[model samples]
Target: MTSDRARLREENEALRHQVATLRQELTCLEEQMSFLVNLCVASHRLHETADRRELLGILREILNNIVGSEELGIFELDAKRSVLSLVDSMGIDPAGFQSIALGAGVIGHTALTGKTFIAGDGAAPTGTGLEPGLTACIPLRCFGGDVWGVIAIFGMLPQKPALKPQDRELFALLERQAGLVLAMTRPD
Candidate 1:
């Protein structure tokens, strides 16, 4: 049997080593968690902004930054008719496509279902009248759960890796921001 003093010293050393290992792991996890939290906070700030045009611009920037897509749009919903009309957009010409109907095409399906749809299977283009590739339509809801609009994102050539979960998430973020911005700008 070992002496009591030696046994205690060994046990103490083992415990100290364990604590140090735990501390290192905790520090690493904390740093990772901090990064994730910062991402969420930044996204929220972008979504909750009150400036309409600024919010649209920021939405475009965020979508472009995250998904690296060149074509994006925000289509306003005609509540009475439940149609989506072009309010603003980027990378696509809006002058000829405004007043397009919702629930009449792909954008309509995405807005009506309130979900994301993949369009890479040679699916024909929808309301925007643009050529379609891998496109994502995100529902935009305004105050009191009113469906205000949608942020439609598309690419002409198929994206490598096709579609991704991150792409959907980024589209959703763009949708939320677009709704907030549209509400502030549209006439009451």
Candidate 2:
């Protein structure tokens, strides 16, 4: 009878451990779902913006509230001049990055190659023009495989010290959706 009680106690403990693990997994899933929903909302807001200023504000909102970053710059590519001209920026000096040549720094490299660059990933080449604390550079590509601009993301919030899988997903969403929105709204 004593052995039976010990076995039952062990089973109860195992079941309790399993329940705790399952609860943790559920919590993680909920967080991811919330992030995805926010991404969708941000995309919708970008599409609904009527002008460049509104678009910039929406971009700022996404970076600040979603990505947890406040330092960002949006540079439009001028193919005729082969230069990236800053369209809007925050938390960084605009004069220093007013016009970046194609393939010059992180912004230029992304504009030239249509490749996203993330700092500390060991993928950015030396002198890539990544600012002192910047973390990611994403090429804004419109439909038909054309890159129209670049979004330079500086430091993440202290709470978000490093990039996560969700952050990468958000970047991808911005790369695709933000480009389309900008292309549609850009003046001819």
lDDT of 1 at 103: 63
TM-score of 1: 0.65
Give Cα distance to truth, residue 108, candidate 1, Å.
2.1
lDDT of 1 by residue, 1-188 (tens): 46998999999999999999999999989966765564575487676767777777767776665566678777888868777788777778777557656566778766676665666545544544453543777788777766678777776334543555556655566556557656877776
Best by lDDT: 2
Q: How much RMSD separates candidate 2 from the native structure?
A: 1.5
User: Where is model 1 more than 4 Å wrong at Cα?
Assistant: 1-42, 120-131, 156-161, 175-177
Question: What would you estimate as the lDDT of candidate 1?
Answer: 0.68
Model 1 Cα shift for residue 83 (angstroms)? 2.8
Backbone steric clashes in candidate 2, count: 1
How much is 62 displaced in model 2, in angstroms?
Answer: 0.5
How far residue 129's Cα lies from its native spot in candidate 1, in Å, is 5.3
